[model samples]
Target: GWARLADDPKALARLPTVAPGATEELDLHLSLETRLAEATAGETLTHGDLYPFNVLLTPDRVVVVDWPHAWIGPAHADLVMLLSSVALSGIDPEPFAVRHPLLTGVEPEAVDVLISAQAGFLLAIACSVDSTADPRLVRMMTELGRSSLRWLSTRTRSSGRSKSKG
Candidate 1:
């Protein structure tokens, strides 16, 4: 998610529409990059975009189908992305978070940061696109952006008003 943000300066520039104070918020987050990095020190496989839509389940087994975003990162990062998607689906994340093995030994604050980054990246992309080019897709992105932003705000406030992680 951070890599996505880093690669899209134009989109990042338009993020304030969906996330107010995005520049300062991202700057504060950037300052804590090393700490965030330290929190997930091990090199493990991560499903960079783990979400409900990317998973497939059969009678016999579960399969995670999207591998393009796969990379070496903290295992908890994949869990965080999964929880974020669940939250977007109007599900409470607490129960799932408690049971997920990937979240073992992970800091709650670190998860919050990852979720915020995911929200911010989505908002940037949603705001950057040309709406008229594809109204239905744009509308979907807009709604997703709004939900993600709301989730970000709720997480921030609950976490004592911390700025988002870029």
Candidate 2:
């Protein structure tokens, strides 16, 4: 379900260039920072890396596999990562939510936040893995990373307004 981008080369070339300090990078860094800070304060549970491949399913049973990246932090962090991966892979997340009742009560916007965070993390990992040498995966990571940054920026702005109102 992972959709490959046509502009993979361009996208891969953009990853390392994307970072916090750049004006375009602020929103993502802010959202990640906020979530990380909240996680540090015990606001959420962390499951380092969660993706569909790590999920095992059978009729009437569902199991979460892989624990290497597991940690205690924000639950949203895991959720975001899952959502982003789903989007990147060109899969509809709605079916996943329907099949997994635990996701039912989560707000759509929160899911968006989770996707952003997840995408950013994945991008960072992909970029770090010598992505420059692998053009296809590099492009996928780059495009996904860009989407993640945009999502983070939106979430940051919305949260900022909410805090100001309160």
Candidate 3:
């Protein structure tokens, strides 16, 4: 599980240098896990990893590969993962989000939560693995970790401001 990995000692130890103050925020990932669990109360079939290359589309039918991470969770979780994966390619996910069939009638707030959770998960993965010990791969993973940390930090600040104003 992503949450499990986030809490793993090995995972934390493997993380590259992150932005200032981010370490404190990341240390609270367990609280994020609790929030995710609460938002994901409704169980449904979900393909955990829906990255662009994982799907195959020919002239006929479309095939989805990689199912080892599939599980039962909120429907929006899959949409969140797919959109987040798309975002990794520098594409804006908002326009695509509204058009996706799976995102129909889904709560945006729930998707936000899932996205935040996914970012945290990615941070763990980026930290824990060396990716064949390639220098380029290590750089990419480190960059991803930094990006996720920035995103989480921004979201945390915005959420806190929103709550304080209400």
Q: Sort all candidates by lDDT, best to worst.
A: 1, 3, 2
Off by over 4 Å in 2: 1-23, 26-35, 43-45, 89-117, 131-144, 153-166
Which ranges of candidate 1 are over 4 A from the true structure? 1-36, 39-41, 131-146, 159-166
Query: Backbone collision count in every prediction?
Result: 0, 11, 0
Per-residue CA lDDT of model 1 for 64-101, tens digit only, reads 98789877878688777666666667876766776788
For 1-166, candidate 2 gives per-residue lDDT tens digits of 0111113554345455653322344343444444533333335556666767778899999888888887775455566667656655655544564466545665555554455445555565554565346777666656666555555445546555342221
Best by lDDT: 1
* Cα lDDT, model 1, residue 37: 57
| Candidate 2: Cα lDDT at 90 | 56
- TM-score (C-alpha, index-matched) for candidate 3: 0.66
lDDT measured at residue 159 in model 2 versus the true structure, 0 to 100:
50
lDDT for position 146 in model 1: 52
Q: List runs of model 3 lying over 4 Å from the truth.
A: 1-24, 27-30, 98-101, 104-107, 130-166
Each model's TM-score?
0.69, 0.52, 0.66
In model 1, which residue pairs have backbone atoms overlapping below 3 Å?
Answer: none
lDDT agreement with native, every candidate: 0.65, 0.52, 0.60
